[model samples]
Target: MPARPPAATRRTAVGAALLGLVAVGGCDLDDLDPRSDPAPGSGEPSEPPADADADLVETVVTALSTALAATSAVPPRDRAALRPLARLHRRHLAELGADEPVEGGVASMTAAQVRSREERLQRRLADWSVQAESGELARVLASMSAAVAQQLALPAPRPRGAGGGS
Candidate 1:
């Protein structure tokens, strides 16, 4: 009969096997390194991601900027309440730390383009407000504004490709 391995050798072999298993499973080791960009001619279909946060920010900024400018005046209390919201928007965008400024375009964008996009949204919101019945106009604006406000208030940008959290 073959001689059994000594207890110490048996333990060492088991330890080595376990170590190898862990190394194989660990995230630190990769089939493809994440640090590298996707290969050219990979022929994988990948759409550029939507800039939902930036879009919402631009919409709110444009709509609020235009509406505030267009009105003869807003009540002092309403204006005061709006101040923090505006600040929040700026702070959130700053936190996003996007190298590019919030140009309306996903790729390169300029301030003028951003402003134009905002203006368009502002007009749409205004028309919707006017057409709404039973104070629905105010409700719609308030709801959209609130949604943007909530998104702005988040502590960090959502991860690059999916889902959200504070």
Candidate 2:
């Protein structure tokens, strides 16, 4: 592995990255989405986001994959509610320039399982985002983490077209 940059250099890189992101007037996935014309992961290897610390990205990927694995444990009745979160994790993986993860075997997802996996993913994303060498990468990771938190805080989504009594 290449020697990590000195602290001063890393800090400079982080600052420059943030400045560049600010110059563009955006910081979320909208500006960072790479899935335009040719498609996001068109079998072509993508360059890691600006000075993204390889180790940090790897950690995020692991967390994401874990969350995806948890998806398989979702009970049949709950699959509809959890499906979107799984899809989002897949998108997050793609945004990180990572390959698609294999799905886990089917099993019943208990409330404890959902809470444990999702919260762990959120924790890892938040913690690693802070240590990211690239401000751009950090921002993206933080956003992903926030999305997880938002989803977990909300009531489980009802199946589409399932309405309550008038």
Q: What digit string (tens of lDDT, one per residue) describes model 2 on residues 47-117? A: 54443376777778877887887876766666767777888898889888789887774366775577677
Deviation (Å) of 146 in candidate 1: 14
Q: What is the lDDT of residue 83 in candidate 2?
A: 77
Q: What is the lDDT of residue 133 in candidate 1?
A: 38
Name the lDDT value of residue 22 in candidate 1.
38
Task: Candidate 2: count the clashes.
Answer: 1
Identify the leading candidate in terms of TM-score. Answer: 2
Q: What's the count of clashing pairs in each model shown?
A: 0, 1
Candidate 1 worst ten-residue window by lDDT: 26-35
For each candidate in the order shown, give its overall lDDT on alpha carbons. Answer: 0.39, 0.70
**What would the per-residue lDDT of candidate 1 be over residues 1-166, giving only the tens digit for each residue?**
9998767654455455445533443312122222244446776645544432344435545545543232213333234434444453444334323222332324333333433444455456545534533242234443443334343333332223345555
Colliding residue pairs in candidate 1? none
